[model samples]
Target: MFGVEARALMLEGVNELADAVQVTMGPKGRNVVIELSYGTPKITKDGVTVARSMAFENRVKNVGAALVKQVANATNAVAGDGTTLATVLARSIFAEGTKSVAAGMNAMDLRRGMNMAVDTVVEYLKSKAKTISTPTEYAQVASISANGDAEVGDLVAKALEKVGKEGVITISEGKTLENELEVIDGLKLDRGYLLTNFITNTRTQKCELDDPLILVHEKKISEASKLKPLLQLVVKLQRPLFIVADDVVGEALTALVVNKVRAGLKVCVIKAPGFGSYRIDHLLDFVALTGSKLISESTSLKLEDVTVEMLGNAKKIIVTKDDTIILGAVGDKQVIQERRDEVTSQLKKATAKFDKEKLEQRLSRLSGGVAVIKVGGASDVEISEKKDRVVDALNSARAAAYEGIVPGGGVALLQASRELDKIKTTNFEEKVGVQIIQIAMKIPAYIIAANAGYEASMVVGKLLEKIENDSFGFDAAQGEYVDMFKAGIVDPVKVLRRAIQDAVSVSTLLTTTEAVVYPNYTSNSNSNLHYN
Candidate 1:
């Protein structure tokens, strides 16, 4: 039967994981080189990746490691940052719980107390949050999370400013000119390439049509005779033609592809999106967007009915395997404006969450300008690290815009802990919980100070005393407490809250574990142990 030995095993494994991960918790944190099973070594400072690389032969140890990994992964997923903080917090909480349990404290009591503390701390954090307003503040938040890289932060801030709040930002790893970024007046379509053969540009694996004539038809075209007139007209214009149709089959589809292959005609066709009324609405939307008339069941479903007057124009159309994006749609300004107004009205009335999100996306497409950041590094390792940093910087910047920023460098957490001291708890569970959280809150700053080779207790104690109401705390790097925001040390409120929520969840769950079941012991293999 499982007893003290099992609990010890669990706690020991968890402690090891936490200690290794915590070493990489701060700005001055060290990197870890992990040797893969294939004998390739990779170095990184990312807590989630480091935690994931660790493996244990003992089941109980593995279980403990798994719990820590879950917290790291979940924290990163919610906030796109703060993996290291979450790992360190979870480890600290677990260590405290183990100590209390050893001193005859009930596991359930500890769990309840921690839960109450988490809620209280989170609420307090929200109250202390200051919404980021200036571009300098935005850059500060981005830079802190991007390993103090000011260039990355500046890039993200400028790019976001160009794209607006609702505009999309896409990141790709590639080589380009230094500090190069592009903003395109484009729309991200939901429809992709209809056929691989239709992809005109093999180099980019995209079907790029320049100033292509757009035709939106709802009916299938199965006969070459039906398209003969439209083909003749397109040939006469000597411009590429893009057909968005319900279906193009039989000789009509074959003839179009054959002619394009033989340089007889320039044409690419894709299936129109949606069905029934939805299909009709999308067609109508494009009608205003591209100034294209619909040749549907109502318009006499025949290519003979297709005329130059019905054709719309797009400055550039790129059809990829996943979707089609159009730029500079040339349509009647009045028609497009009217359609935009209608969508805006619909968006206001959209109640369901999904409907609201979809409407918002539609509105974004109507109002263009999407920014793409092409990030590059000299090596594979550098590129991978840069990509992660860029993403964290972007997300942190957006989070700052969406909510606000708070004092960083453990100052906020220390301040949040002080908040719990103001509340008087009658229940013993809540009181104990508050006490635990108060200690847990100091862990981050303490670890940060320790990582810098300074006395943790002295740094944290001074911070706890100095940061009473205002946002001020010890800067581990400077060895003194100062106003965090003024020092350009800030974090997203969302990221901090998310990290605490996930850390408490994992820590509380791990605290109540009474047993470590090693099932099917005989079948177990690969008994070698590993650590990071």
Candidate 2:
């Protein structure tokens, strides 16, 4: 167990990580070149990547850094942008809360204040956000996120506009031109293989098949004898087969592997998608996707029941541990429509117990189209950096399209902080919480100013006096106060809200951390390090 010393150590570590990350905060911020021990160096301003690249000699600092990295990861996961801002905000809260904790302020009071501050800031952000409808507004958000790359922004905005809001966007390295975006028909499946045995080509870790027949079965195939007739049919037809079943156990699995590896028969077997009864929906979706027949053991138990006419044909199927994506699927529009209608009706009938995101995603998959922005650069490092920026732009544009936009350049947060400061709170805990967030709000502007070679204190003071105009804030690049929206500097409201919420959560947890227990430390240790 540890007390003051541990807290100080933790704070120092946190401060170090914050110092390393916050430098890459705003548009005026500089890029960090991360040199790995066994790879080419990477140059990026992405906060999450930078934080992950950092190493601390001080064990305490490393521990602190690890905790704060959660903020970056969570922010990236939810909004896909604002990792740096979130990290900075969290550091500020943790720093401010540390002072309060040292002054004998109750941890519970600080935690309570943080919660209230999150609610207030979120509400304030919502109030300030402007609805985004036009492609131009989306372009602005994307441009800012892409580090002022107008081409990337314009391309992403146009792609999203063409594909509609429900459409998916993905990025890949390109061979020609700095890049281009293409819209193609496709669907994403959440079900992926856990074993590599299904992949016939070990060199590429891929199972390549041409016009493979799909078998959607409802029961487990435990015996090789049960699968023999189907295997013989695949051999007779001289075409690859894809079997989707509940489970292919022991002899059945071995037989398929032998037939594929030794006899050179193309066979790929994967467990039917989804969990429990939901697996039925997945199998149905696959049937709709490929226009395959729904074959179940409940309907026919005999091997002869599997006929060539009963199987569906797919152009290609790719599997990975995370997910499976079927490409060039020959879709039956009528069948897809029927399945979509069924899923929609199920969704309408679904209670809160049903997973809404999953259902909605399934519907989107059924709709079927993906826009890919293949980013290209002169060098590997450039490509990597450009890829991150384009992805951020894509995600930021999507968020803006989904939720709307907020005034950026730290204007929204500063405005909310000031508004909270003016709020009259009778309770001491509430007042303290307001004060902590209020102070923390200025951190973004301060860091932005400092990064741009301006006096942070002077810039923050100037911006504070312009509170009358919520849109006006210190534009570090210009070293003057201006309207963030007019300057084409805006962020998705969802990104800011996610950052603030995660920051408050992590900061509150840090404040309540009273001790650091090193599990590996023992009194019997002969090393110099000692703890009591």
Candidate with maximal lDDT: 2
Q: Report every candidate's CA lDDT.
A: 0.79, 0.80
lDDT by residue (tens digit), candidate 2, 289-358: 8877777755553554678877878778776655666777776889899988988887777665356556
Cα lDDT tens digits for candidate 1, 379-429:
666666677778888877877777678888888888888777776665665
Residue 88, candidate 1: Cα error in Å is: 1.3
Using TM-score as the measure, the top candidate is 1
lDDT of 2: 0.80
- Badly placed stretches (over 4 Å) of model 2 are 188-282, 298-364, 474-481, 520-532
What is the clash count for each candidate, in the order shown? 1, 1
Q: What clash pairs does model 2 have?
A: 13-61
TM-score of each predicted structure versus truth: 0.80, 0.76
Give all candidate RMSDs, comma-separated.
Answer: 5.7, 6.2
